[model samples]
Target: MREVEVSEITKEIAELCQEANFELGEDVINAFKDGLENDESPTAKAILEQLLENAKIAREDRVPMCQDTGFTVIFVELGQEVKLVGGDLEEAINEGVRQGYKEGYLRKSIVSHPLKRENTGDNTPAVIHTKIVPGDKIKITVAPKGGGSENMSEVRMMKPADGVEGVKDFVIERVKESGPNPCPPIVVGVGIGGTFEKCAYLAKKALLRPIGDESPHEDIAQLEKELLEEVNKLGIGPQGLGGRTTVLDVNVEIYGAHIASLPVAVNINCHAARHKETII
Candidate 1:
């Protein structure tokens, strides 16, 4: 069995937190570039260009792409063969978030309460999702989800008979309703099957996937392609102005559900889909 130090996890989480906020991933940048070239609307193309430029500057200067640095969302893939030493895993992750936000000059966006909201000054207590996998390496992915796109997300329980078409229609409808709100052209993550909450979790988890990658399942892959084409055709181009590309891509993730249920969830990522990952 492999023994790993919790302090290392903390440090890695801290760096991942800052890096995710500060830099746009390569796949995302390429998607924007492709959007700019393919977009027919002059206004939309210009907006995409600005976004590209902003990404370049952020990376060059080591600064966040957006002012709202977002809530630190961490996905941990722990190895069953490894044992954690030094501290509680969750606490270590939070400490990493605290230090990263403070050190990186990233904004603190988490709050203490929903109804009576108050800001958490240091952005501590990250939203951590841990899963045990058969391996010896611990993989961590940190994605800072901003409010703009996240607020526009939706969840629904469609009848099992609705099938693939049902999910496609629901997602496209949600994007249409959310036009210009979630900061198009955006990346749409569709979670199919699973329980209601599990569907939502999978949808959010799909956002952590590197942009431009297609779903592994052939059926889902076709759905993603169809959805991507349809969403871009909405003319809700960059920043909501009319254009040929409203969405950069659609990523669908599926899991098993009950015979009677088909839970669908939509998680949207803005043009600035900031994420970074590390293994330790």
Candidate 2:
């Protein structure tokens, strides 16, 4: 078995938090460029250009692409053959987030409580999801999810009879209702099947997939394509000014569910899709 130190995890998470906030992924940049090329409206094209410029400036200046640095969401894949030492795993992760946000100059957006709202001061207590696997290597992914897009996300319990068409309709309606709130030219992550909570988690996880990558399943991939086409047809366009680039990509992740339940969740991400992954 391989031994991994908690200090290492903390150090990496700290760096990743800053990196993700500063460096926009190439896939996202390409999506915006493609959107600009295909968009018919001059206003939409201009908006896409500005988004691209913002990403470039963020990278060069080592600054956040968006003002909202977002809630730190960490995905960890722990290997059964590995051992962690030096500190509490969760605390290490939270410490990393604290240092990352503070040292990197990213905004501290986490609140200590829901109703009795107060800033957590350092963006501590990151939302961490851990999965056990067979290998000795651990994979860590940092995704900074902003509130504008996240607030627009939703889950619905649909009748089994609703089927694929109903699912498609629900997703489209949600996007329509969201309009420009989630920031248009968005990436839509749709999770179908599983329980309500599982479906929501699946949808959020789906956003981690690289933009334009299709699901391994052919039917699911086709559905993603259909959703993308239909969503763009809505003419919400870039920043909802009415154009042809309402969505950059549509990703659907599915899982097996009970015979009676058909739960679906939609997670939206704005053009500034920020995530970084490292394996150690």
Candidate 3:
């Protein structure tokens, strides 16, 4: 068995936290460029240009692109053969968040309690999702999710008879209602199947997939394409002013669900689309 130190995990998480905040993935940048060529609305094209400039500044300056540095969301694929050593894994992850936020000069937006409204001070107790996989290495991805887009997200528990059409209608309606709140030119993550909470997790996880990467399943890929077309037709535009570039991409992730239920979730991310990952 391979032994991996928790400190190593902490160190990597720290760097990822900062890197995710500062960088916009190439896929996202390319989508913005494509929007400029295809969005039609003059206003949409202008906004897209500004977004490109903002991304450039953030990367070169090594600073966060958005003021709301976001909740420190982490995804870890841990190899079962690798034994964790040196410290508690969760604590290590949290400590890494603390150091990363402080060192990176990122705003700490996490609250200690939902109703109490107390700030965590250092962005500790990150939202961590860990999975055990077959390999001997650990994969860690940090996705900093802003509140605006997150607030616009929703989950609908539908009867199995409702079917795919039901799911499609729900997603479109949610985006239409969201209208400018999640910040236009958004990336929509749709989760089909699974239990209610599991679908929600899947939706958030879906955002981590690179933009434009279609699912392997043909049926699922078709759904993603359809959703993107219908969503852009909404004419919400860039930043919701009005145009055809309302959505940059749609990513759908599915998991097995029970016979009686269909749980669907829609998670939205704004133009920043900040996420970074490392394997160790």
The digit string of per-residue lDDT tens for model 3 on 1-280 reads 8999999999998999999988889999999999999888999999999999999999999999898889999999999999999999999999999999999999999889999989989987799999999989999999999999999999999999999899899999989999999988999999988998999999998998888899999999999999999998998999999999998889999999999999999999998888989999
Candidate 2 segments whose C-alpha is farther than 4 A from its true place: none
Error of 2 at 238 (Å): 1.2
Provide the lDDT at 163 for model 1: 76
Model 1 weakest 10-residue run by lDDT: 207-216
| Residue 132 in candidate 1, Cα distance off native in Å | 0.6
TM-score of 1: 0.98
TM-score of each: 0.98, 0.99, 0.98
Candidate 2 clash figure, as a count: 0
Tens digits of lDDT, candidate 1, 1-280: 8999999998998898878877898888898888888888899889989998999899889999998888888899999999999989999999999999999999998888877778889997688899999989999999898899999999999998997788888999999999899888788888888899999999998887777788888888888889988887787888888998788788889999999999999999898888888887
Ranking by TM-score: 2, 3, 1
